[model samples]
Target chain A: MTEPGRQGTPLIQLRGVERVYGQGDARVVALGGIDLDVWPGEFVALMGPSGSGKSTTMNILGCLDTPTRGSYRLGDLEVTELDGDGRALLRRYTLGFVFQGFHLLPRVTAQENVELPLVYQGVPTHERRLRARESLAQVGLSGREHHVPSELSGGQQQRVAIARAIVSQPKVLLADEPTGNLDSARSHEIMALLTRFNRERHLTIVMVTHEPDIAAYARRVVHFRDGHIERIEESS
Target chain B: MLGNALREAIRSLGRNALRSFLTVLGIVIGVGAVIAMVTLGRGATQAVSDQISSLGSNIVFLRPARGFGPGQSIIPFKVEDAQALAREVPGVVWSTPVSLRTLTVVAGNQSWSTTVVGAGEGYLEARRWEIVRGRGFLPSELRAGVAVCIIGQTVARELFGADDPIGQRMRVDKFSCEIIGLLDAKGQSAMGNDQDDIALIPLRTFQRRISGSTDVDSIQLSLADGVDNERVLQDIRLVLRERRHLSANMEDNFRLVDSKEIERTLTSTTRMLTTLLGAVAGISLLVGGIGIMNIMLVSVTERTREIGIRLAIGARAADVMLQFLVEAVVLSFLGGTIGIILALTFSFVAAQKLAFPFSPDYGIVVIAALFSGAIGIVFGFFPARRAARLDPIEALRHE
Candidate 1:
């Protein structure tokens, strides 16, 4: 945890990003305008009240949703107006997402789940297996690689999900409530796992959470109120 | 990438084992029914045509017009009429003058009532019969009007069980005729008559002793191969008309029956029947394809969240669609393979039991398999598109 923002280039830059749903009367603005920048090798938490657009911000940051009126440059590439395939390519190479619900494929084992992203990226089987095993080990799920999600505890399932997220060696990890479904003890364990990966690999992590304790793991926490960033707090 | 798609599809399909099997079941029965029906139909047609062709494909039957239908009596045809047909008919190569009489033949302690057909040495050639044992009546014997006969298999078995009948003499009413030959067994005629329940004798002897008349009952003509049978029929008609002195535009006093025409008629009728059966079976295949489509749609809806997760993890929409399509194709292809094996076995056994040729046409099988696979692609396309077009955020939000 000694170094923060040490990598040369700013990884994610967003300016005047807005996402509006529907048209005319049905138009409910999900993200009014979001201006944010995340430097390389930084871990940031997005915290907000319900319906304050924390999820919307995560979706945009994860490249799952496109902004209505702004520029989003993800590592020197404009992503705001990019098509679905272009965003997919960016996600494949640069971004990883861990959902709040721990969306591990139900019938498949942890190792197979971890190998999914690499499979989509057309990685060879041997390399995919090696990298999946390595990622699972990094997430403290070494011996549970063959256990399916149904056979695992909530925390273990979430660990498998994290392994899947980072298996492709993505530069940016976007996690939405990684500990949302876990208890206090299990939540803390997951937070420690994420912290070790962030600190050791210098992996830039953008996580969304309402719990202040969960936000405490990040070096900086950005608070959101009504689709806009209210304030940013830093920890020593 | 294809391998990955296939692997993914396999996993998803394996998740719901019963549903996967049930979904493929429709295809299985459809392909199976089509194959079995076509195969069995062809077998039946082949058996029928074989039976009809056994009546002598190139032979024509010349009977007095009054001899054909019930209540029609005849003065009968003359031996000279058959001789004229043999000598002067354009396409005729041989002729057999037939005269039949129903009489009780006695041998040792056994007596049986059977129809005895009187014809020349050319009868075997005209009827395409073979002397499996002994020998047919010689020309000299036919000319001499010798009391000799060639017995049918049924007659031979009835009179001489477990014993040779070649040199045996059977009583033909007041005349005793030696069994000079035995005709091979022909199970049944196209008209369902047991062909082995009669006996054959030289025509000259039959007319002098049995019939007490010189009038031949019917004339059977064997025409040369490659000659137009209809033209030969017309030539015989003209000759018979002249001999019978029938007026122009009047119905002739004779009937010229072409065995090949009967065969063609029966074949067309059976071909039509098989085609109709094939069409009905094809409908089941179409219904099976519809079933696949319905199941695929349901599968896509059920797996919406999985699709969402894959999309979020950077899976292309095309990739997801391909996975589902490949899954459907695999299911249908596998169903087709199973159906083909089952149909072949079913047809083979059924053909044997029904006494017909068991010709399993692999062309139909190959086409059926490909058709089933193509059905998968066509039917799977819509559902795959639905899954691919799902909004990732909305899908993930779905419970």
Candidate 2:
């Protein structure tokens, strides 16, 4: 894997980003002014208790939500300046996400679930099928391609979701508490798979979790509290 | 992308097959009722025109008009009035004074209740009726009021059965008459009355032997081909008014019934009824559209998380909207197809039962199909907009 310090330019940069909700009396601050940078090929973890703005930060990074104030840049594009559709296009071409709930469409088979992102990209059918199968195999789900979400175990379903996120070869994978519902053994297996992708493909990763044991799998860990980044530490 | 959206729509609808069917049931019933009503209404209108045209297009009936009130009296016409109209009116090709009475006629122990008509010479020609057997009345027989009669097909069947009615004797109220001719069958009139259940005798004979009065009920006239009907009618009115001695300011004690006028009135009335039925059925179609809207709203709400998933995975809002819209369209289109089939079957059977023509209006069928699809687009829009506008962050958080 490439060393984070060896990279001259960060792949992702956030400068004084702030997110606010509602207005007037109903106003709430979900994220205070914060600054951060992530180089290419880095596995980063965000850790905080509930309401610490970690989830909010992950949402903003995934382009699912926009910063209310300040600049966010993914590569050369200014994300905070983009419109809803523009941000959606950015997500479609550059970002992937694995959620805590493993949000696979309930009745769709694993192969179809993995093919969704490619479908959104207007990929042709035969090639889409081939890529989806390859992604599923990469996640160690070769024979479970036709099984629906309800028929699969939680770990297998999350793997399918991971396969879906990475199927289009996105530049960055944003995983929010991906193993939150899995057992300790399944969580380790999932963490190892994420780590292998990060090293083997040099894919940038940004993950959020509350557990230190899970945070330990990343090369760097950032702690958050009360809508602000408290500190960040690196590990060899 | 369109193909994918369509596949997605079909798959989602299949997930709730029972709900989808129930949702489209309203549309099915609405379209079916509209098509059946229009188809059957057209058939009834066609039947009316056909029946009226069968009565001969150039015929007109002149009858004494009763005054407005309930107990008002009517002045009967004389046979001389028919003769005067026939001579003085330019377009009057044939005219006959007709008097009618319902009587029970007995022949060889077989008796039947039927109408007995008293008419002057050339009555059959005025009515465009043919003598299917035997002969018409002789001039001497008609002028001398002889006891000879002609029987219609229905009268022949009821009084004589398979035997020849010509040369047979049937008893009128106070006299016996020999059958000299047989009239062809005319089937039923527009009013559903049996037209062929009648016996015809000379007017003088009827006046002398049956009623002992010289009163005529009505005058039947046939206009010559290509004549101006209104001019001829005005001429007849003038002649009748002078003969009956009506002053210039007095209303003539007569009324004219033209075949064309009757046909127009009847057709317009049936068309109005058809429009009324179509409007009522259109209201039901609107209700069906509302049902679709209601179900689509529910479906969007139920699939909030799915929308979120799609959006989070980088699907455009338009994509999500298209999927739901296509689902609604497919649903209503399916209902339209089934409704058309049901309507065709129902109208076919009903036409057979009602004894009218079975003519399906293909234009209306095509219109109903397209209209049902339009309903989907119109009603499905609001819910689709709601789905497309959802915030992915909140939607993903929804359980």
Could you say which candidate leads in lDDT? 2
Instruction: Residues A1-236, candidate 1: write the lDDT tens digits.
Output: 46775457678898998988899999888888888889988999999998888888889888888888898888888887689988888888889988889998887899999999999999999999999999999888889988889999999999898898888889999999999999999999999988888989888999999899999999889998888889989998
lDDT score, residue B104, model 1?
94
Among all windows of 10 consecutive residues in model 2 chain B, the one with the lowest summed lDDT is: B66-75
User: Which regions of candidate 2 are displaced past 4 Å?
Assistant: A1-8, B66-73, B138-140, B162-164
List of clashing residue pairs for candidate 1: none
lDDT by residue (B189-236, candidate 1, tens digit) is: 877888898888899999888988889888888888899877888888
- Chain B superposition TM-score per model: 0.91, 0.93
Looking at candidate 2, what is the lDDT of residue B361?
94
Clashing pairs in 2: none
For B243-277, candidate 2 gives per-residue lDDT tens digits of 88777877767899988889889999999999998
Interface RMSD of each: 0.8, 0.7
What is every candidate's C-alpha DockQ against the true complex, given to 2 decimals? 0.76, 0.77
